[model samples]
Target: MAEEGISPSRQGRPSMTSSMRSSSFLREHQQYRPPSKPENHYGIDTVVEDLQATSIAPPRQISPFNGIPSPENPPVIVESGVSHELSHPNCTPVPGTTSFDRLVATLFYKSTSPRVSNAIPSPIRIPSPPKRAKSPTPHTESEIPPNMSPSSSLDTFPLEPPTTEPEPLDHLYGSYISPMCITSFLHLMSTFPLPPGSTDLNSAHRCLKLDTAHGHHPLVVELTMAPAPSLDYLSLSDLRKHELIYRFEREWNVDVVLRSDTLWRRYPRLVVFDMDSTLITQEVIDLLAATINDPPDLAARVSDITHRAMLGELEFDSAFRERVKLLTGLPGSIFNELRPVLDVTNGVRPLLRALKRLGVKTAVLSGGFLPLTSWLAGELGLDYAHANEVVIDEATGRLTGEVKGRIVGKERKRELLLEIAKKEGVSLDQVVAVGDGANDLLMMEAAGLGVAWNAKPRVQMEAGARLNGDSLLDLLYLFGFGDEEIRTLTR
Candidate 1:
């Protein structure tokens, strides 16, 4: 007897074949028959056709460096007798525009097409990973799976920038500081007000290298905090923040510029400068006064007025007129002598050169005479030059004690800055003003980044940032330029 659903030959050993028949065999050979049409069937031909139709990608070439092909040495692709190179290592011959390369490239590069801001995530409600109580265990090469490639593992688990659901009043602070100072700095910062739900102070901040330059490339320390509810009733109450920045500067001997971690200030489109005392060591007007020592007391008197005007103690227009009147009989040829003698402030040339290389428009707005301003413009390759023009007697070729055009006073300097920014199609927020006098306050206030360059106490207190470094080239650091970049630009 045979078991149900089992043939007599398969009853004994499961490996027994139909050809090895028992004694009860009905015939030596059995007839062959194919399955009915209703049964499911699979064949080698069907598998090959399905694979061709789907256009399945072949295994990607594993790059020796970081498992991703370098742009310089991309994988070569052959199509229609022409060998084309694909920069994306993961790209394949997909049928439509929905290739992996097309989708991933958008993630890395900016698009010129108009953006739909409505689709963007809320700035304050970004998602972040849960905080870890301890440092993560170090990962070793042996921990990687044997069959998994490096790129595949990266694709499976990608590193992402931190996202947090911070309050609307949360503030961000960025500073260039040395590694040794960070611990002490953070210790001091711990006293600052923190946002609600805050845990560890150490976890609320991060440090990163903003540049790869050798020799004293400061790491950028970013601290995020939200003022206590009692202090956050109004948005513009930043007295404490400014106080902290000032204290930090005085203690560290380095400026800690406060700004959003955004791209706007990093790349300014225009930089306007004050000629006297800012771009140059001496006031051109004072230099002009010294040239005429007929009275011997003339230089001292003029210097007194200039100092008063720069300190905001006197009106610029009156002070300028008083100084120019003393130079009534000075010969026009004096400009020729002073042109070569005028000392440009240290780092002015390199700073201007770097700005020019970056395609930033450079200008000189001077309260001095137009002749000297024009000469400096040509020497330093400034894009625009504006100054008060001292009228010269046509017959005698001497100063006539009269200004020919609109005085480039405080108001006019600001107006000129806007006019130039408009002409160049740059936003006011993309402009930087550098000056040292009270007259420069209006223009500096109007610009996005107002730097008081070795200015008086009044100007330093009111300006956006104060720079007291020995060289004006230190100004580059405010724009996030590292030593390597400064060297390259100056070179």
Candidate 2:
């Protein structure tokens, strides 16, 4: 500085260090040199090392002129002080590259973009899934317009295409759900109105169509079609309405009319008979003992055990053993002799002929012996027969005091009844069961109509219907059979 030349110690700064230096002097003397490029040696690793080393060192003393807070003992206020100083006028951004304005604009109006408008707005409006067509509205008699013809009405509406999606709202709320329920509903609804050109008499007997959305169509109607009563021949309309009711009762409710007319007029397609007492008067076991010439005391014991076994009191095997033990010495030849002595009950041939002529499937499922039952099945033209076999001692050719194979007990009998119905291609409701013992209870319970034909006290109590005074033909009556039909069936 003494000679106004560059000093060796002032190599880091320009000579115009004094604040009183004029702007012109600074501009004239200042040598403006562009910054030279640094050597390409400091990499990301070197920069990280430098930063870590600096972070470990004691903080540098901040200048008051810098307007930054002091670095106190713990330096707790350093971050806050630096943030505050940067927010002030001293911390200006570099020009052209740094954009504080753009950042602020982004923060303020982020959601106002057109991209967001293209997205879904409400959660509910997010497309609804397609649904299946609803079940067709059930048709009632009232739904048929009085002047419209059914054929014309049918032609007016084409069959709807089947829906592929899940079921629609109406089906989720409709009352007529099942096929059976729809059938019953339509049947009941038919009683209300008659279609065009349909008389009450014709409408009462005609079948009605039941439509469903799920491709199920069925015809529902009464099982029988009979002429309606003539108002002139049985006129009681002038009398009190109750008197008309009584008069109708007098015509329809007469036993002779129902028994001799209605029931025999409407015969069933099937007839089933119980083996023990219905087809045969005496229980097969009693005839077996009589043929063996066993003592009365022993025969009575066997009968008691047989009864208990039939009533489901004792296990079939156990009861059978107990009964056979009494006949241990009885010869096997007695079975052949007993077969003929077995009492064929009254109305046996006539009942079988009637059932066969009616094209009815007749079966004999008994808790009795197979030999006896199979013989009867063959003789009576029975469709099927299932029963137990008595085990004989092979060496002695006499009773072994045991039963072989499955015991046709109550439960087994019930199983056989179902199997028969299935094999015969008949509805369980069309099958008939007739029995006279307590053991027959389960089979009776399973059948469509369980008739106790002159049954024991136990059997009569459990059966659906009872037949005492009438022959086996009385079963025809319960099936809506009339005397004319019964006569045709018998013939």
Shift of residue 417 alpha carbon in model 2, Å: 1.0
**Each prediction's Cα lDDT score?**
0.69, 0.55
Question: RMSD per prediction, one decimal?
Answer: 22.1, 34.2
How much is 135 displaced in model 1, in angstroms?
Answer: 70
Least accurate stretch of 10 residues (summed lDDT) in model 1? Answer: 101-110
Candidate 2: C-alpha lDDT: 0.55
Model 1, range 386-473, lDDT digits (tens) per residue? 9999999999999999888788899999999999999999998889999999999999999987888889888888887667756788
For 1-491, candidate 2 gives per-residue lDDT tens digits of: 57556565577665555684665866657798344656565655656555555643467643223334334322233442463223434356677654211000000001111111122122232332345745366333343233333446677553642222222222223222233433332343234333344454322222222234534432122222122233343321221123322232222211111111232224445456668888888787766765555465777777888777656566766676666667677777776666777777766777778878778888888777787888888988888888888777789988777788878877888888888777777776667788887777788888766777777766654566555633565555555444556677677
Top-scoring candidate (TM-score): 1
Q: Which stretches of candidate 2 lie over 4 Å from their true place?
A: 1-270, 292-296, 308-317
Error in Å for residue 165 of model 1: 40
